[model samples]
Target: MSSVSRTSPTLATLPVDMVKHITDYLDIDSLWNLACTSKVFMEFIQDLKIRTGGYHVDIQKGSYRIELPAEHYCYCNWEEDDDYLIDDLNKDFKDFQSLFPENIDFLRIDPNLVRNFDRFHQECTVLSIGAHPMEYCRFKAETCPTEKLDLLLNNVNFRKGLALNGPKPLVTENKKIFNIDWLLIRNVTWITPEFIRKLKNKIVYLMGTESLTEKDINEYLKDLKSGKIDNRNLQVIGFNTGFGRPRYDREQVLNGLDTTQVLDQTYKVADYDKRIESELFIGTSSANGDIKIFRSFDFNRDDGTKVSVEFMYRTVRVYIWNQDKEQEKEKVTKKRGHAKDTNGPAAKNPYSHHSSPPPNVYNCGVSRYLLPGNIDYLLIDPKIAGKFKNVMDCAILSIVTFRKGLALNGVIPKMWKIWNIDWLQIRNSSIPIPLSMLYNKIINLWDISTITEPQINRYLLDIRDGAIDQPNLSLIQFRKQSGWNSQEILSGLGTVRCQERKIYKLKDFDEKMRMDTFLPFGLDENGIELRDTFDFVRRKDGVKCSVVLLDWVVRVYVWNQMETKKRARGHPEDKDTNDATAKKSCY
Candidate 1:
């Protein structure tokens, strides 16, 4: 006789949906029970869409997180259990990879009587995440079932920092997430520009958003200037749209906004001392002048508050300043960095102009916001240029060597040389200004005007023959007068042409610039972007340089970057040269 056998149905045998409903009633111990039962159960538990407290547990982040509490994680009773129990548990902990090495001791200790409740509890708090990975409090999945994130965030104090990183899209109706001490949101593309207009966080950084437009940035700045949005607690706020995106047009962002240019080294924002700029741009110094590197625009409010708008390659930062004003006690937030020295007054970088803005101090190294009272930044009066036998070490942004008098009160003007002047404007100046003026100095960009075509020709020829050797000079320009010949400038130089076709962009600040001319004001403003170029090799060191000869100007681009040299495909000698980015890196 055959007997029919009946088998008991377990979670492993049941549908995955049924398994989730059963686990819903289970505690942390129940989870371990199912996970430790067998290989099938372990994977079954892993696949369940369970979110205990803060973390998704579904995945992880490359970012660092603070500690969460360990409320329900009690010590295990290893009396009858084999070493396999602890082994599987340790293996799971290691898989998370968030646990500290010192906190995990199950593997190194004896299995018999090693379940110390107190230490295990402490370790669990370190490993177990609840509200968020970096939050202060802690809880076990058994304590609270998976619920809405808004409800979870609603219960959190958030005096501590907050970070959201989950693979799934978050659904939160709560508006409170917008205002925190410090916050970081990964995959923040869902965030709207409307949300940005309401940001009150002290330091907020939002990543992975392709929807935020430059127009949004312009409106935000306008609001700040109009007092439409005010967050006294706010210190640093930035939006970094990934690379190759449209640049945050400075002219558009600060359009019609009354701004105060900060000339002093300190760009004070409540004395918070968080040097976020340096932390983000750590790789700044080694970089050549391929780009503008740094530029800032600041303004003061009717309420006496100061605001700074800084624009970079493809990113933007808004800094609110209340120098003597204080805010609430600081909380744990994403630390961009801290100021190098804040104890005393800032020391003037003696050689600031001669080198790359000293690493970590690019903020200070960028030319001051420019004194509003000193609007003649372009024209360095010949009288002032004659004062410093050597002001080489000074943080002089641009020099104007026009035939005029300079007004300097403190130092008592004497005699000076043109040393380490970054943006140089020589009005009514000649090609031969004495090698002493250019020798061993860092002059990255130069604009000379009112010079004859013959003089410009002689200068280019001398540069090729090793007669005019300025290693640190990256680019120099000679503006053409009415009678000048553009054709002669391009053909006279022994040169080569590159293949890449492109349009030029020297549009730094606003669009009100005259598109064709390089006026004296152009030195302080922007330069003409269009150009036709030829390459030349310096006889001295076999170094190559690019010369952009335009109908209106003649520009000699030296210190050609190795990347450009290798990538610059040669075109037919008959074809006009391809392109060159303004502010090409210096030697």
Candidate 2:
């Protein structure tokens, strides 16, 4: 029999600092095992403990002591040795948990070490899976609750050949009991739709080499086209060159679809000097056939070691279907300015609701006559008529002109007359104006006065001065008072007034009103003619009489035949010399 060495390797055998450095990479199980191997290893681990204490407990002389309120417990350990550490440490940890009834908030075991989860019961909330493929697969299938699992795999093999078969039994058994929150896979290449389905509530984070055979790509495309795959649930997909030079353009990598037998996609590519390291894609699709893609790129450290990295990101185009059905539905249900009355079918007597008797024949308060189809014949109460006479005149004229196919200018008075009807109350009582009539009146009045230059200017001024305050003032009131209803007709005028005020406040009157005083007809300094030419004068026989004041003032006056002859002889244009001199003197 070969002689076996009794003394196992200890921390003293290696540099203490170097041994501590190695512990950083070892998982929790390795650390626990290292502590259990010997007194020296245990002492070293205790002395080099990395956790900063938020809560503390002191078990002096073998008696357990609680020092803080316990909500949950999390433990992590690391060690250098495998055999002496892993096997024994797991056994002791389980035994210790049984003796100590405190709850475990989360339990993470190194994949290299065997796990006995039956001892912990429901105490475990979080677990980690490492690069060991067989061990990870077995742990997921046996110990992990499918729905509750928080899988963290770093530099792990998740290729087609190494993938787990079907849904793990544990996942199926406990899915109703819990929901998976997260699934982190690093340096993983193959992830299937089935795998995604199994991890429904879980958000997946994937990194590393990404490759899909042409067949697989075609299948994915088929699913996208057929609506079998719900792309809305797919939150993110990312790709980046790892440890090697970029073999393909980043854009080609993202655009999954092929055009001209070449895939053209857009991707955020990191700089080469930055040593492009990783990429992250995030966001989900919408139910209405919309896909939102968010992409980010990371830069590797220049030192070639694991260090701080920089990331840049952008959201690319969103894919959506043009939905005409919604627009069509909106159009069908949309409300218009006028809708057919729904109180009842068309009235047998449309004029039965008339407020007054026919206008051509007054019946006072006794007889109600049908309102004539000809609005001019409709009778209004005397009191109302008196208040809205101008408005009525304007309205009647407008209706007559409109019916006669007259110009718009002739229809304004009729519109104004109808608008004035709003103030036609019964004595002291307020009479509600019919919305239809009021609208018609407004439309007519707007058409008439809106076209005139003087009316527009006055309207603008009234609006600017806030003279029209009430938005619901009656037209009858406006006409009787020589003003528009402050309430009903002035709300729209506020904006116009504000703009006019700003312009007027900023305008230069002196520069704009410059005058010229050189011409025969009262010309000002700015060369603007103040009077009409001789052609504008009225002619009587061969002589002309001034039709305007300025023209009259500019005509030459000859006291006698000799003076007239002299003036005529002097110059044909000298007839207005006196007027021109007068204009200059006035200036």
Candidate 3:
């Protein structure tokens, strides 16, 4: 008894990674045996417990399932050691009780587990109590009372949620539990205005029960839209009539929640000193992606056409935040050097800058840009929204288009919403105009008084002969204006890759181009859209040269097939960078 015996080689002596690897293949019994060896091993098992989201127990059935870290069922097979298993389970329950005092993100309860409910109630943010069986049990020779359901509903321990199979009247016994974050109520017939008024959750899914009235539904929607519900965290709500579609209040529920609207604010040309920075914002209609819209802004060259911008983004939901005074100062400080102009204050010559070129330069021939002050409204267009399947497909189309100089300029509305990747096969019905072609001019006609044909020809020839890159693109008429300057208004030239054939696959060309069958617009003799189609036979070292003709101006695009799809239109990360930089400036 006095002699000390050395313990056998402990697995803890192995490296942590090795220990983890070995433990991964062990059964529940083996792991438990190892855990029993030392406190260190028990801690390691607890790590696995956390990673696997702990155990899920069916208290009534007296059954437990270990949830693996991967969210799959644990690979461990059950051993017939009932005594050992019960002991370990009790230990685990006690361990969790000691670990979480504030709340567990998710918890499930059954009648058998009600004894410990009080001790663990504070740790659960989501609680699910199994619906009591109502069907007549032949073995019992009687129908079960609603005692279990009553107990579940009246349980005071559940903090955030009490999932019910159907809605029930208020229980005075418990006087309601914690603020409900998830109300998965079926048979919504019991739901009333008063019931909805007291409900608080980020997500509410109502099913069955036709007891709800139009007025009560309207009040519910009104409260939801005004952020009076959900602790101001509501992100999604779903309604199902459980029969045919139920009719209730429409107006407030439809357009009341952040309906898209533009505030009364005029965009001055001089306000954008540097070339206009155009951006695209994208949003979805629901958490399930029932609709999506791409919103963008385009300014004219001379800044004369201020009326081009509109406010709408298909079926997408939007949230426009107005920058406070302090935010404006932060923005200015962050984008200091990017302004690129020091002439005068924008207030002095608000209309000095040139507007964008004519409507033909853009797709849809409509500019729906929203200024910062005007972005306070949101919209979820019913007309544009569809089933989740179609919405996901549209999202994919939007993303693929974005990679090709099309960009995303906005954020999704909530956390639970997800973009469906399988829906990418559906192509866009509208052809997107390249933003490069939209912005960063080689030469602006509004900046010059006059540019002659021969000079344009020489400039084009130089670009063709490789002496100068393609340049001098404008929409201005050389002879129409009075002022004449002999010197050429030549900005530095840049090259764009020309291709022998159209590079990527272009689907839905007819629908996207909106081709007129009888009287075609912008179509060549072959009926191809001339602006997007071009061919050049002139080859220097087997490279063809093509040019874009805009009124009296010419912009050449150098043929490079490899670089065709490599252009950076813009990126979603640009917004993040801009935001981070703005925030950093504040700091």
lDDT of 1 at 415: 32
lDDT of 3 by residue, 146-222 (tens): 55444545553444455544113222223453245445554456566566566445445555536664455545544
Clash statistics: count for each candidate: 19, 37, 25
| Best candidate, lDDT | 1
Candidates' TM-scores? 0.32, 0.23, 0.34
lDDT of 1 at 464: 80
After superposition on all CA atoms, how large is the RMSD of candidate 2? 40.1
Ranking by TM-score: 3, 1, 2
Rank all candidate structures by their lDDT, best first, as comma-separated numbers. 1, 3, 2
- Give the C-alpha miss distance for residue 95 in model 3, angstroms: 7.0
Which has the higher lDDT value, candidate number 1 or candidate number 3? 1
Candidate 1 residue-wise lDDT at 526: 22
Summing lDDT over every window of 10 consecutive residues in candidate 3, give the lowest-scoring window: 275-284
Query: How many residue pairs clash in model 3?
Result: 25
lDDT (CA) for every model shown? Answer: 0.42, 0.28, 0.33
Query: Can you write out model 1's per-residue Cα lDDT over 89-168, one digit (the tens) per residue?
Result: 44555543321111221111111112221122212101112222111111112222124454445543333245553322
Worst lDDT run of 10 residues, candidate 2, spans 498-507
